[model samples]
Target: MSSGIMKRRPLKAADDKVHDFLTTGIGRVKALIRGSVKGFAKEHRPRSKNGRTAKAIFAEAQSPTDEDGNEIMIQVKKLSKIYGRRPEEALALLREGKDKGEVQSMTSNNVGLYDVSFDIRKGEMFVLMGLSGSGKSTLERCMNRLIEPTSGQVFIDGLDFTSLNDEDLRIARREKMSMVFQNFGLLPHRNVKDNVAYGLEIQGIPESERLERAVASIELVGLAGYGDRMPSDLSGGMKQRVGLARALATDPDILFMDEAFSALDPLIRGDMQDELIRIQSELGKTVIFVTHDLDEALKLGDRIALMKDGRIVQIGTAEEILQNPADEYVDRFVKEVDRSKILTANLFMRKPKNILYETQGPRTALRMMDNCDRDDMLVIDGEKRLIGMARSDGILRAMNAGDRDISGIVSDVPSVRPDTPMSEVVQIMVTTDFPIPVADDDGILLGMISPSAAAETLRNGGGE
Candidate 1:
């Protein structure tokens, strides 16, 4: 009877504590809302879907061509571009090696591209990247039936251009696709306006319409005043701009760029890459951009098709290919990309859950929180979407909110998703003045994954 009495007393005492916690915690949260909402609304009124007020916040990049406007899709079918002495014998030896489980050999000279295949979806920035002599350039040229392949099919906009007659191929190039070379290939005799207008000229466009299109293209390339200047009078970067303008002037559905910025200095190269991305965002054409630079590929490629020995070793989104490379060669190509620039918010959005912030008094919430080891306590409304975050440590601050220095006790923190690439997590963790909320597909709270946690996740490929 005595032991039963003692147990009953402790249980009764604990019940009273929990009861106080609930009532007081709710009061404190109500107080926080009362204090912050008005001030927050006054200072930084919440943005709407298109950056307006009184609604949600959602925005997307600008694209000039709608889904129907750009339609020249490219698909490479078992592409092989081999050029060297005794190609047939070399191929035979390679086949023999494969049969003998020795797929690589020392005495091989036919290195451009060997039996590669992949597709460039319409209105996608399909980047082909590899080291020098990886046949990236050759493979790109072969797509538009520019370079004659040794023994593979080149399909453009669903037509097998490799098997097409010269007249048909010429018509296709003129009407459907345009090429940009490493050298500007501008006519020295003509000014920038004429150089840009040359493609339309070849296609029998009237000079009046061609010049108008040329001027627009020159402005598009950011070479407005230089339309009257000759190619020799321009710098290397400017000359490349001239080349890009020429390609754009043709108004072809597909654009093939071959090492177009490799000749410029590093700063100029970066600028050109930015310009290309901005233009690509605006034009939304099916771009097959060839380059040996991995960083450049990451910056521009919607889907990076990493090529090796003339074959597409891997094909995926920049994140997919970088995070889960198909093999050793592809892995090495994307090992050093600075990932923060490409991280998107949707990647961190987690599945929705039934978590709600209990509006409790500071002391009560702090005492309750002290009994656990959770990184954070999510505060949600009736909808269960993220409203705010309450840190485990923040409970203590909220409790001591009376202290003048603890004015900013409750603040905003970010959260992330389970499958989010760690790169985005790191950016939010480093840049934002808060912790990240890790969630699932439906905006459900899945606990917090910190920057350190994210880095470790990447080191182990989201395992362990």
Candidate 2:
């Protein structure tokens, strides 16, 4: 009798599996695990606190997730103020002048804000957003009392801000808050280290202590070796990092970033944003961010306060802002957002039931694949050993194979381990032609899927 011939793949070594998983199939496991183990070997799993797992710490440290959650951190109550002179008629002013009783208001005609009220949670990044001349920056300044409000009260950390005298306010600034400006505000004459340490030096820290603190701050911003460089020698992003280090070096109660990254190029801006996120994750500082860019607001805000004409229009998170826009203005702001990157697979992924993948027939597998929005189908034999995958291309190829052989085409094989990310799955699809067989580490088929299905799911309300 003829020996039963079986097509067998060369067994790969342990390291090869790691290399393949990392390089060709990264997205398949990008969800929980970053890349494959071989690749992530160098990647220091982000250190967590109190010996907690990254998952638990992640849940704790993700960020100001939404408006309602953010409200608990920072609170503003019926905050109101105005600027720019209301049209003062000459006749009315003349009558007032005759009285000399009209206390001449020295306030400017430009109103920065009016009756703004909101609360931001601890570990939240609150963003103040507005367009040009909308008074968002003015509100930011007022929040930290950078530009003193003409009228109305401000409170930070329940300190009754408007009530603080100059001496008290100055002390609060030194002890409780740090600010970053759009212009960076670096000292041209000072080197990066000296400029960053300037705040500590101003606070009368000893020279040795200040220098040590400044070096630590620089490393925190990823400018580890650039301490001696001057402001003129640094790039825009590096300069911003210096500003970040300066703000952080103070170890204040809150960080105020006022258009801190608006000056950089898009790529550099993204880098800075990522850096800020990493810093925020590590430090967990309360941040009050000011920006005009809606994208930036969406990118960073735990709760975004949208301002118009010196008044708050809406305050919510990226999801809330995208899903429940307050008005046409807010709607227009995010009309063209690509939501896939924002929403994750947690919104989708349902278990397939009544999935039929008989070894001989393609119809069962195809139907199941369609309903699950999966790119491929799982194949099984009598014992359900996940024998193979039933795929569109394989079925077509079987048809083209004509008379002699069709059974060998759709054999179940090469299943990926569970906990693979969609990105990894897509990368595999790009590199390989055959329908990818997904399996547990023991090589049991759990069914098959493809990159296209993942994209479709994301497009469809995150498979809501």
List TM-scores for all candidates, in order. Answer: 0.55, 0.54
lDDT of 1 by residue, 1-464 (tens): 99999989999999999999988999799969967764554333222223331111111212233255654367677776656665566556655644112323444545456667766678788888887777788888777767788777866656566886665566567656788888867889999999999888766666667889999999999999898888999999999999999999988888999988888899999999999999999998888888888878888898887877656678888789878999987766565443443443344344433233545555555554556545455565444555566665766766665533222344555666665666657666667644477755776665655455555546655331
Instruction: Assess candidate 1 and give its TM-score to the true structure.
Output: 0.55
lDDT of 2 by residue, 1-464 (tens): 22322222233455578887787676465634733453545423222223332233223322323445343434566554444455233224423532112312432333455557776677778898888777778777887787766555665654466777665566667656789989999999999999999878766666567789999999999999999888999989999999999999988768988988888898999999999999999999999898877788888987898887667878888789889989987776675343334433332234433434455544444455668776555556565556555566766666566523224665545555455555555556667664455566665555556555666755665432
Model 2: how large is the Cα RMSD against the reference? 23.4
Error of 2 at 429 (Å): 24
> What's model 2's TM-score?
0.54
Candidate 1 regions with alpha-carbon error over 4 angstroms: 1-72, 97-109, 336-464
Best candidate, lDDT-wise? 1
Relative to the true structure, how large is the alpha-carbon lDDT of every model? 0.70, 0.68
Clashes of 1: 30
Model 1 score (lDDT) = 0.70
